[model samples]
Target: MTSGKAALLIAALGLSACQSVSQFADPLAPDIVREAGLGEQILNSGDPNGAVRYFERAAAATPDDVAMQRSLAIANMRAGDLRAAERAMDAVLASDAATPQDRVERGFIAVRLDDWERAGAMTAALPPDLDTARRALLEALVADRARDWSAADAAYARALAGAENKAAALNNWGVSRLARGDASAAIATFERALATDPKLFAAKNNLAIARAMRGDYALPDGVESDRERAVLQHNMALVAQRKGDAAEARRLLERAIAAHPQHYRAAVEQLAALEN
Candidate 1:
């Protein structure tokens, strides 16, 4: 899937997901806050682009409003506009009113941006007392990047322990297991994550990936949308490609296009890439 709809969400916890524009009290213009609030509602409704429109209005009205900027940053991230998020988050961090959550948000963005060094810096600078689960998850991701598997495992444990959202932590752990080439273990972990939170999209998507890695090409049980199915098929095709099963990858991409209700350009493109 594209980054906006999702990315297997192996990283990028989407820290600001379904959260209010600002965790702190809103002392700014009510109009800006209300506009941002509408953006948050729209974001939660799965229209990041629509959310961005509302957030951009808020930002334009009060460019210096840190709270508004916070919402804008997350809105842009959800919209798959990391460059916009980067600028907004950087401005947020530069302000005296910035909070630890803002820094952590930046760290996730950095990870998505493939700037592991910057992400690590933000992770290292994070305070120990705030949102331990997210902090530990960040540490785990950075550790995994450094090839420090032991550190990653330990941090994932801590993340699960303090996780306000246990399914998310478990899902990430499952992805980490997949990264380690433990498909069986990853499947079990993903199953556990799903059992804990049946609606966790990443767990469902990752479970399909795990199964595909284990040589199962069937779609997972709960993916109801054709678009989602197409996305999952594309992901499985990538897994097949990675395993050098070009034939299987091509077949899956073909299946992806067939399953899609409309033009699945991504699947078509992947098919082209695989064939060529």
Candidate 2:
């Protein structure tokens, strides 16, 4: 199947399994609530364009519904219509009908827009219990981007304490440490992150880079068993190329691309680097 078809199938399967799609009616139920629920169903079923139309209708029919607005914003974001997402979020923010959940959802949207300050402000409005691990992760990213390393570390520490995003927290914390000239500590932290979540692609990717930086080429322990083994092998080949073994690099790269034909970036880049 085509990648898009596969993605749509997965989306449809996921929606079919979700209680949120089947059990939860729109907050207002009946009237616009029913329409909103149908819209969300369509969105979850991988038809973002159709979902947007329904959500737009629901939002217009009930302008006071912060929930519908939030859903519309999320649909827009998923459809890669950033401008529409921004408009929907703005509409939600302008509405006095917003609940804490709305604020939190808006915070998430702000993070996607790279408006860290706005995200922080919206997150501040969320209740403590509702201020989730995701919110903390966004705060950490914002702090890290702004060069507030201490705050970033603290936020990541808090986020990981919840145990939901342990891998991401550890990986980002390692980056914070690396920025501070602590290569060994960064490596150790990344290793710990990998141990905590073996399937975390970002952690694995960063770990490889960190190891390469230290002139260490050993593969991380879990790669052989990973679903991303092909990608990992490709990364290893790139690393070999960097270490001046063009012949072995080309061989490994070819092996990886053979394993996963969709793996293009690594194969293409390594091929160019070797030929040059």
Candidate 3:
């Protein structure tokens, strides 16, 4: 039996040829088509490493195919191969078939590559009305990196105004505040983020970090994952240490390590230090 990905690929290929298999004239050979389909499935499943391997093979077989190149570029970006992604996106932009999404992704790639000039150029070329929230967030990040606090603040406000998920923007805003040494504002922003989305782990983590920075120890509410709970416990342990309670700190660290063995490396190290 064909897998779901394979079946989807076959259907897409059939549609491309505008006929059933017996009379179909697919532009790509069966093997290449199958690989591309599997690659897309892997990408959708969030396994960019696996997707990259399959996409690389399909791209090698169909170098002139813009869609395949775009897939390869996205897979590479997800897999943290920014240089390869940039090259592939450059090829896509050079083609006549590049879309607005392509430009947005390429602009993000330029941001990740720290090519600020290129990123600005790409952002400038984007259609003004497209993906306003995402564009604003990206611009905010770029401005933050450049230490343009005023620009970052304005862009972040725009992001929050238009974003569907305000938790991310709030968390990032907290981070920016923390970077600027406003611990009180950062803590409040992180709390607001948690109130907006209790399941936002980044916000939870930032909240823990902000509390730790202020020598305050309190367990975060509404955390659902053992790993996140462990992180919170670890942060509490740090608070204990800051308060000169070595025994309590050790206990908290041990509890953190017990809560999530896979995510308690810092707790383990801290426990060992306390013991020593």
Candidate achieving the largest lDDT: 1
Q: Considering TM-score, where higher is better, how would the candidates rank from best to worst?
A: 1, 3, 2
List model 3 lDDT by residue over 1-276, tens digit each. Answer: 123332332233221111111121111122222334634566666677888898889889989988888888877877778889899889989999887667766777777676878877877787877756667766776776677878989988997887777887777777766666677887898899889888877678767766755666666788787887787787767655755778878888888899998766988887998899
Error of 1 at 19 (Å): 21
- What TM-scores do the predictions have? 0.73, 0.65, 0.71
Report the C-alpha lDDT of model 1 over 1-276, residue by residue, as the tens digit: 332223343233233111111221211122222343634466566777887888789889988888877888877877788889899889999999877767777887788788999999998887777755666777888987886878989998998887667887788788777767667877898899889888777778788877876679888777878887888888888777766799999999998999893767888987988778
Clash number for candidate 3: 0
Global Cα RMSD, each model: 7.8, 11.0, 15.4
Q: Residue by residue across 1-276, what tens digits does model 2's lDDT show?
A: 233332232233222111111112111112222334635466676677777888899899988877878778767766667678778878877878655655655555566566778877876676676544555665676676577778878877786775455666677677566555566877798889878888766567656655654556556677754336566566656555655667767776776667676645656665776778
| TM-score, predicted candidate 3 vs. hidden true structure | 0.71
